[model samples]
Target: MGKGAVAAVFALLVVLVLAVVVVLITQGSVAIPLGEVVRVLTGRGAESEITRTIVLDARLPKVVAGLLAGAALAVGGTQMQTLFRNPLADPFVLGVSSGAVLGAAVVILGTGGVGWLAGLGVVSRLGVTGAAVAGAAAVLLIALGIARRVGDPVVVLVVGVMLGYLAGAIVDMLVYYTDPDRLQALATFTRGSVRNVTWDELQIISIACAVVLGLSVYLAQPLNALLLGERYASSLGVNVRRVHFLSLASVAVLSGITTAYCGAIGFVGLAAPHLARGLLRTADHRLILPASALIGAAIVLVAEYIAGGNGLTRTSLPLNSVTAFVGAPVILWVLLSGRSRKQAR
Candidate 1:
């Protein structure tokens, strides 16, 4: 697509994201007015303290968390697709998220007592986040090693799926023997939700995501070269091994921090890049990266709204349930339309 078209698409995505943010902030149980939401967001204080508290405390963190998690996952997914030369590669699909969940679960469930992690404040959160990052990195390394030896995208994809299941199985066993009270903390890890993210946790998420996302900008040209093949990328002095290491590390941090806070959100990583590519009509990482981030953020916000942002329902649905509606169809289209096979070869 032309630069103008790309710019227009990005503009529209930004607008969509902003619109969703407003709607989510305003449509919750108490129904704050748009004017008030805007006022509070702009630092003009709301008419009522309760409205201010609800908007700033209750909703803003969720919105910010969604934006960060979506952007991070989308970028990680884009990188994974290019690195593996597989259309289906993503952190969640490749078991990275599940690994992170397992790591966090160990920390949360292995603690001395119920709510141990929660009671310790930011330090404990950091420990869990670090463990999550370690677990994601472990899975990433294993997957990359296998992918290199196997050298088949389809096989790599299958292996990734198996790894995910293995990690999840470990988590299930842990949950089985754990205290029921600690299980509540593990609940979100499986289902996914941004509702519990606090301003402090957002601090860690924002910093880690910011650093990794910035690094992705540097990796973009190298990634684009890898799309042609590792040999071609190496021919162009891309340092294929270094590029692979950096890309995998980036994916680990992005997926790990997101899963740590947001609870193994699926499909946004898998679906958003495809949507961005479909819209941009190109695989240029420079364009695809930012576009994917915007699209991913919008998708998560919309899903959150549908899942319970409206506050009409007493119980919110698991985010994975809402995201599957988008991801499953994309997976089918890729398989049936031969996109996955084409990319595999």
Candidate 2:
């Protein structure tokens, strides 16, 4: 697409993000009015203190969490697709998210004080987050190591799927022996939800996402070279090994932190980048990265609203339940349309 067209598309995405933010804020249980939402956000004072607290304390944090999780997953997915040269690669599909869940599960289930992390302060949160990142890194390194030796994208994809299943099995084993009372803490990790995120957690998520996302922009040019293959990328003066390591590390952090906070949010990473590429008709990471981020944020907000942000439903659905509707179709299209076959070749 031309620069003008791309600019217009981005503008529309920004507007969509803002519109969703307002809608989400307005649709919660208390149903705050748009004016009150705006007032609270702008520090203009709400019509009532209750309204202010609902917007600031409850709705706003959830909305922000959804935005951050979506963007981080999408950017990480975009890089994964490019790195693997596969149309279907993503954190969730490739087992990185499962690994994170395993890591968090170990902490939440193994510890006798299951509720301690929730009641404890930042230090506890960091500890769990660190464990989650370590798990994601483990899976990523194993997958990359195998991918290198095997040199077959299709084989690598299957290996990732198996790894995800393996991690999930281990988690199930832990759940089997653990006290049911303590299971509440681990419940959200199986299915995704942003409703539980707090301002303190948001502080950690925002800082990490901001730093990694900034680094993604710097990695874009080198990543583009990687799309041409490692040898070719090396010919263009790219440090292929360095780019591979940095990109993998970025993916691990983004997926791990998000999984730690939001549970296993399936398919946002997988779907968003494909949608961005289709919309812009380009594979360039420079454009795809930012575009995917916006599209991802919009997808999650819309999904959240459908999953019970509408306030009509008394019970909220697991985020994966809603996301699967979008992701499953994309997975089918990629497979049936021969995109995956082409990548395999």
Candidate 3:
């Protein structure tokens, strides 16, 4: 794509994201006006106290959470696909999200394996974030170790899927033994929902996403070199091992923190990068990373609109259910395109 075309594409995505954010804030159950939503966001007040409460206090935080989670997942997915040289590779595919969820489950399900982690700060935002990052890093390290030992990318992919399954089984066991009261607290973490997050937690997610996302830009050139193969990347003076470590760490932080706050919202990480590549028709990370972030954020916001936790539907639905619709088709297309076979070659 030409510079102008790429710029135009990114510009459209930015405008689309802004428009969607406005729609999400305005179209909830009560259906506040766009003016009121903008007024409240701009430090003015809506005429009705209830309207103000819903827009500012109830929904704004969730929208922000969705935006952050989407961007983070999308960026992580782009990095993983490049790192593993597989279209099917994602944070979810590599079991990074599963690892983070397991860490949070450990805390939520308690050390005794039968109690809640909530006790006047036991389940604080920082605690869960820490546990999640730790878990994601651990799983990432394991996957990388296996990749190093196993020459075949497909073997590594299987190991990652098994890792996710193992982690899920452990989480299920924890849920089974834990008290019912504590289940609600753990529910959002696993099933995925942005509605319950508070502003304080949003701050944590935003800060982490910004810092880690910024660091990822530094990896763009190195990752592009890596696309030509490790030998070529090394010939071009790229440190393959260091790039792998840094990129994996970045993915861990982005995927882990989002999973911790929003639960294991699926498919954003899996689908967003492919969409970016399709739209831009290039694998260059410099262009792909930001484009992926915007698309990811937009996808999540659209999913939230469909899930209708606020007012669109009578009852809330899992964010995953909505995302799977977009995600599953992409998976099938990649498999049938013979992309997997190409990777094996």
Query: Model 1 lDDT vs. the true structure?
Result: 0.90
| Tens digit of per-residue lDDT, candidate 1, span 138-231 | 9999999999999999999999999999999999999889879778877888999988999999999999999999999999999999888888
Expressed as tens digits, the lDDT of each residue in 266-306 for candidate 3 is 88988999999889999899999999999999999999989
Q: Supply every candidate's count of residue pairs whose N, Cα or C atoms clash at under 3 angstroms.
A: 0, 0, 0
Instruction: Report how far off residue 147 is in candidate 2 (Å).
Output: 1.1
lDDT of each: 0.90, 0.90, 0.87
In model 3, the number of clashes is: 0
Residue pairs in steric clash, candidate 2? none
Model 2, which residues run further than 4 Å from truth? Answer: 112-119, 339-345
Query: What is the Å distance of residue 12 in model 3 from its true position?
Result: 1.6
lDDT for each residue of candidate 2 in 47-150, tens digit (9 for 90 to 100): 88888888888888999999999999999999988888777889999999999999988888886535666567777778778888989999989988888899
Which portions of model 1 show Cα errors greater than 4 Å?
Answer: 111-118, 339-345
